[model samples]
Target: MRSFSRLNSMQTKLTLTFLLILLPLVSVSIFANYYSQSIMNEQISDRTKGALLTTLEYIDQLTQNMDQQTLLIASNPNIVDIWKGIENPLSPDHLYGIHTVQQQLTALTNVNGAVKDAFIIHGESGNGVSTLKGGIKWPDVKKDYWFQQTIKGSGGLVVYVPTRESRNPSLYMSEDMIYYMRLLDVLSSTREPNVMVLAVDKRSFQKIIQNLQTSINMNITLLYNDGFVLETNPNSENLHKEEPFSITVKKGEWSMRLEQPREEVFKLSHILQQFTYLITAISIMLAIWIAWLVYSSISKPLQQLSGAFKQFSSGNLAFEVVHQRKDEFGFVMNGFNRMAAAQRKMIEDDYEKELRLAKAEFSLLQSQINPHFLYNTLDSIYSVASSNRIPEISEMVINLARFFRVSLGKGRDSFTLAETVQHLMYYMRVQQIRKDHFTEEIELDEATKELQILKLLLQPIVENSIIHGLEQSPNEGYLCIRSRIVEDRLYVEVEDTGVGIPEDRLQEIIMEMDKITSKSYMSSPDKPTSLYYGLKNVKSRVKLYYGGDADLLIDSQEGKGTKVTLILPMGKEGHT
Candidate 1:
């Protein structure tokens, strides 16, 4: 009995050790298998969904391409010329016109891949009068119930139909058949009159089949709009299953069946599961072994370092780290100590210097702008008062009020584009009032009227042109503000027909703006500040709002004129 008890004790110890070693491996393998299966299922589902949607998208794109081709052929200028020439089909010239129609259709078909062939159908309406009726057919084009239904349903409807019988034989194999068709009415340029039926080839259907096969590992079968199975890529074994998986296409007028094997998708998931199991097993074993060592090497040191960092962040940079070993943590602590010391010394040396520089720059900028605005405002008022122009004085006051109102838009960064334009107009009015030498015209597109623009953007550019370009010219100058939107961009051009910039100076200005360091001339406090302060302010603000895309494009010819353009961010009008 004692000997049996000893053997049992030995077996229990062996069992405990074995479990300790093998438990992680078994857990990892099971987890990996389950995860792999899940991944495979997800991939299968996604591929099936994407395949269905892509098939519909392919059909839609093909339909659009065909419609565009038909419209192009119908609206061809040559068609009208041919119609005139074909007054009498018996004439040689009239026969040449008939040939021209075929030539035009052929040329269009070649350029538009979706178009199979284009022909002028020689058919007449209900009227007894005979007329030229023409229609084109795509390769493997089909005649299906959809075409007949559309013909009988709508008097003059342009419809997309199944292409089962409409396949163009020239493009597809003789044995392969089409399953769908798209029919459209060829219309005159006025579009009110129908000329003929324009049918596109079933090549789009072929593309849909090919793409669906590439995207999904399934036996895909497309059904016509009238619920007829048009095309199927399948194996013989699965062709006549009594009960098949049917997937309804919610996005399009079609049906699908993914009866293909899903083993590959599941196989990928299995591979991932195996990898994850291996990682998890390794992690669990390492975690147990490292838990104890981590307390001394990583966890304790990390706790000490964290406390030191917190102290340092709270302005106690003099705090010391107590780690002794020469490892990563020791090196980090040493670096932190050095950084803290350097930061302390640098702060002392640079704090006053930075503050002084900032204050001086601020004062200089303020002094420059303060007197400039004062001069413009005072000059406008003085002129109005001197001329006894009460209405002009009132206008000047209103403009001044509006300018300040925009300058402080509740301290917000942006204002409505209309407000920007309004303020810019007031500034221009003030400049015109003060100088009375430059004539300006402002035009804005209706679409871009409500877009938001940075405040004081155009005013400075306009001011710069008026000051540097117009002021230098002896004769009257012209300034125009024109704006338009191309695609998604808003382009505002401020052009002046004054003394244009010299080539050398223009190149220098470009370099200066590019580097953002044209402050040498701006350093002088006694010189005129309009060109410097206004330009610098506008440039800085533009950079703040839109980093690099926002810019100034200057085009000029000395003695002709200078145009300062602001390219800025574009947004929809009244969009929050």
Candidate 2:
């Protein structure tokens, strides 16, 4: 009985050891398998991708060669002169020219094996010639959809893939065919719109790529920029099942895709998984001998690390890891202590920052209250000055009071267009008291009358026009403020028929304004200022509210005039 008990103890120890070894071995095997599978998949994908790219290049080159060949037939001085010769198809000169054009078409078809057929259709003569094996298939080119679209699509190249039965015999072998049409830049005066069409059999072009894809069992499909799939080799029905990888070349408006079957792609991985089971079985036996060693190396350290994290998650940051055995877990425990301390310090620092920030916010709020007081003070001054019975002083005081009233918007970001115009009139009236030469025209659009725009957008711009442009002009100084809605945009243009800005100074002023605008700052004493400061101030405000989508354009000619146009994106109420 004693001997039997000792044997049972030995078995239990062996099982424990085996579990320790098996756990890590299985994890390592999974990682190894995943890595190996990725490498093999990449190899398969690369080989297939290379084949598709090569095939795409060949097709592109073939089409380009076909285009050049068709151009030769369409623009041949003889062909152009033929169509211009006579309306009667039986005329000897016209018949001879038709024969010459047909011979050129036949030579083009022979230029490349992929070029199944070539065609030339003329509008004036009402005839088309095709190198279809039998004869020209159809006489009236206008009835053909390809010819009509080619004329409608301007003079650039056009591509067509037919769905219905094709008239050309070369296209009957497979439905996979493409036609390239280009309008000839014919020099003849009497010749109608001339178009050249080149038919390519995709199957014939794909033969050059068959050997390239042999290394990897992947099928390729070609696509145009507009998502039109060009039927190429092995365009099997299973394409819809798998998501394909694609490649596109810069010069061509074409994209190529490669697809592989799920079973084929995972064949090697399945083999590796079978081998993994064998490795796992062998590991269990070997593990029984060194179970105690693994427990000391991995399990104990892991237990300590797990306990520390568990405590940390439970709101107990104090995790005392006493195991000093130098290993990866020991490093982890030390890192945790440092991280915990840093997090606590960061929390304390954040609390302190919030306290200081609150004080600054309070001061900012206090500063805003000052604007409200100024409005009240202006109202008080207006009453006192108007009571004195001096019209000049009372008028100036009233305008000043109105200007301040419009400037203060009770914390609203935007004001109505009418309010903006009213503010401009108040400011302008004040200026007009001194500069009598300044004449103004308000050509505000009816549509913009009720729209909401950023407050003070037009006031600064108008002020700058009057002070700088009109005041200095040798001619009769005139200022025009016009607002209109063009499509989705709201354009507010400030025009000054005064001495315009010189070309060099105009560019400098624009650059300076851009610097301020890009910084996206409101006009403040702390920011770098501009000489054309009012314009800069207005631009900065415009950008701060609208970002880069809004535009402020300045155009000026020194002797003629100056125009500053503000374009803003419109919202339901006004500029968004």
Candidate 3:
């Protein structure tokens, strides 16, 4: 009884090991079968459609050529003159003229291989010339169906595809001939207008379908006006079944139909499916045998690894697997141990860095208190100056306090366009008090006033413009701050008519700004200061807040002026 219980335990383990290997093999086989069939279906459908399109284009070209030929013959001066002069069909004097017209018609049929025969018929007397039967007299030609149809067409070209019984006996053309007819009214005579007809051979269209069939091994049917079957390869009526794979493409009045048997199209995929089943069966049998042989060796190590993985997933990054034998499993276990140790170290290092960053940010917040204190002191001084009735001191102190208050942003990092512009005004007012040489103008779009932007974003740019651009000029300078929104981006331009930057210095500053705003510079510990530190600081902050889409562009000319444009993206919340 104890031996039977042990045997049952062995059976359960073997079954589990076998199933673990078999399930994935079966799943892969199933996926491969489905994917291969899908690919084959798509490829076959695309190839068939492409072939049908090619055939349609060829047939359209042939029909167009036929129409052009009919137009060319109907308007021929020689044929028009001779046909009009022929008053008597059997008269000796008019026989030569009729012969000339017949010769011209014969030449047309001989030149173009697609034209089987050409004819010129008189509308009233039913007497005209034919390429096949010259100087023929058909007294009832006016009563003929094609002639009456052409006359009713009112000079427009008409095409006719004749059945077997309706083939023209006078021209001796076959049933496969299509007729293109038009009234010869190029030169108006007193008599009824003559009719010009050309019999086009359908073999040209048949040849195109045949060529396509030879390459793709499919049946093709050419239809005229989606109704009449002009030609079909293999000459079989029932070869193209509606239930099978088929495609139809129409061009103008002509269309092409392509068909292939479903079984024939998917023959290769069926073979692949069969082969896959065979492979899957053999793999399952082999997997069961392999599982039996290696179960004892792999069972314990897999359990150890699985347990270690569970612990590691449950926040135990220090978990490791121990194995003595140096096989594939041992290699995996050793890799897991090293990976765990590396992961634990990475987490520790990241935590330490985050803690340091938090402390630094706290230190920065603590440092801002002094600026607030200064702002308060300036406000108090402004009040004192107001009480003493010193307007100049009062204005200066108020502007200074407002500038520092806006710079601090009340512990917020963003403000509306109005507040931002108001902050810059405070700074500029303080500067104007010191030096009144520069004239300032601020033009902002009313629609852009509510757009939230980074605090103090424009202050440093304006400062650079006034100090470096306006101050260096000899005459009175102009400083203009304009704001507009274009294509969902806010554009702010600070234009100064002062001594501009030299080309060399501007290029140097541009290259330095590029370096400062780069990812590598942001990650580095050392960041050197530059003469254009304000501009660099603006570029860096724009890059940090708005990503790479925001831009700071400086266009300058020595002694002319400088324009610094800031393009900021208006994100979903109206701030970036």
Candidate 4:
């Protein structure tokens, strides 16, 4: 499974794709190398064979001319008659015949350049007449192996490589000379016939082989009757070591063999093969490089994009794919970055709007409470004064004046815990005048008193305790407002002993506040009723002003009491 997954990776896929494209080209290159080598081998063989045949033809022509010359010398009427008459070559009577035969042999040798000498031997007397050694006696001729063989054989024209002993000493004969012999029976009745022998220099044949060798760059070997004759290249031992291309041509008793080294013959093919291999290697490297480039260009960006998407889905709006390319991947990455930025901006804008709306709602609630509370307080003061000049009326008026003065706070949105607590005491004092059944207790930690808090943050909770918690109770109620610092946070609690809230009503109030916390307070078409409306307002104000770091929690029990705690983080100012 791991291997298969790796194969599916971008780098692997790119490599495989490059290989797929390269496969056919590499195959063609290899096949062409093989095919070209085969063609070169065949061409070399055919061409070399043609050259060998040409050399053979030249050699055959020389031998054929020599043979014709030998035949002509033996069949001459004078030579034939002289041979028939030459029973004793020491006699003066036949000296003329022998001399005449010598003249003919001389002419025969002179007529052909390849034939260095010619001889006519009398088979019966074992004597011969040579162009070089004229009037040879029977004993002198009989001592020659050529003469002995010619006399013993029944033959027509035959070529021989002469032994050193068989060469005529009188003539300057070379070892490279060949002899062509023809037995003549001009006297048909006599079985003892004469012979005509022509000594041919092999230099002419060597010249022909050398010319062919030079033109074709090959080694040429001439064979006469399967015997070593001459070779154009003497250092052909290396040619035999390795397989070589060879061609043989035969003409009569002579055969020509042409040899060329296989490497030399297919040199072009070998070069092509090497060139193809080099090109293949370079192409493979280039393919890998291109695959790597593609992987870098495509795969890396895709992975970035994939990761960005995951982060975005997980609510990380700041995650962005970074790329510098101007290709498609770059375009996609840029789009992704724009999308994340746009989404982040949208969320921030929505949050800002929610904050503004909540602020406006809090201000409106504060505005409504100030005027209406002043009217009620003034009326209550009127009632207290009209009924009696009570000390309570004086206290209510002073507290109401102080409450209004502190609630205004010179347009400040927040105040120190001490100032906010002092404001709360003034409001509770006014409430105490209205409802004497409740008594208030205020305890503040010095640490908390100096901490800054949102204005009107505690007032609504104390009002709720007085109006809803303490006002309904027939007996005496207690109200406690306390502030403390705990865990780097400011905690202010308002506790009351009164009728308290039923469990179901408390749950309803909490659910309503939760709804406002979860969504924008102004999202609802209708405003909250008077029931826990001040608490809802405080909840919304706290959420908007302090965000999640501040909260309002309510605890209540039937006929027991109610408590509302405001939690605010230290060292953080509430949002206006």
Cα RMSD for candidates in order:
23.3, 20.9, 14.8, 32.0
TM-score of 2: 0.41
- Candidates 1 and 3: which is better by lDDT? 3
Per residue, candidate 4 scores C-alpha lDDT tens digits across 1-576 of 464356358466677779898998899898998899888878877877777777677778877777666666656666676666457654688877778777766766676677788776675675666787776655455555666566566555777775444455423235788878777763355545567777777787787777776534468888888887877887656687687777788887789887777777777778788989998998888887887677676566666877898999998888878767898778878988988898999998897987687667778866755553574566567567757877777778878777877776778878887888788888888887887788878898876777777788788788878887788999897888888878877888989998888999889888877766534555764566776778877877777666677788889899999988998877676621
Alpha-carbon runs more than 4 Å astray in model 1: 1-338, 341-345, 348-352, 372-420, 433-460, 467-493, 511-553, 565-576
Segments in model 4 whose C-alpha atoms lie over 4 Å from true places:
1-23, 90-93, 137-155, 163-174, 186-189, 215-217, 236-241, 268-271, 284-576
Q: Candidate 2's residue-wise lDDT over 206-269, tens digit each?
A: 6654555532446655666645444344546554567643333322876666555666666868
Write model 1 residue lDDT over 1-576, tens digit each, in one string.
474466446555655665676677777678767766766666667767787877777666665555555556555666644553232333454666656666665666567565543444222211101122332223212233333443453333344443346433222212233322222233332221223334454555666666666433346665645444445454435434444433556444445555554444355565666677677677667656655454565466666767887997897756877667698778988888788788867776775775565456544543444334554565567567657868766666666666765665665656666677777787778777777888878788888677777656777788778888888899998888887777667778889988888899888777756654234223333433444556666665465445555677788999999887777755422122
Count clashing pairs, candidate 4. 0
lDDT (C-alpha, whole model) for all candidates: 0.58, 0.68, 0.76, 0.74
Model 2 residue runs over 4 Å out of place are 1-20, 85-93, 124-126, 133-144, 164-176, 186-191, 215-217, 226-251, 266-270, 281-576
Which ten-residue region of model 4 has the weakest summed lDDT? 164-173
- Candidate 1 contains a number of clashing pairs equal to 33
Cα deviation of 125 in candidate 4 (Å)? 4.8
Q: Best candidate, lDDT-wise?
A: 3
Clashes of each: 33, 0, 0, 0
Cand. 1 Cα-lDDT:
0.58
Over 14-89, each residue of candidate 3 has an lDDT whose tens digit, in order, gives: 7787888789889999999999988998998788788788778877887788778777877777767766645655
Return the TM-score for each candidate structure. Answer: 0.37, 0.41, 0.42, 0.44
The residue-level lDDT of candidate 1 at 265 comes to: 39
- What is the Cα-based TM-score of model 1? 0.37
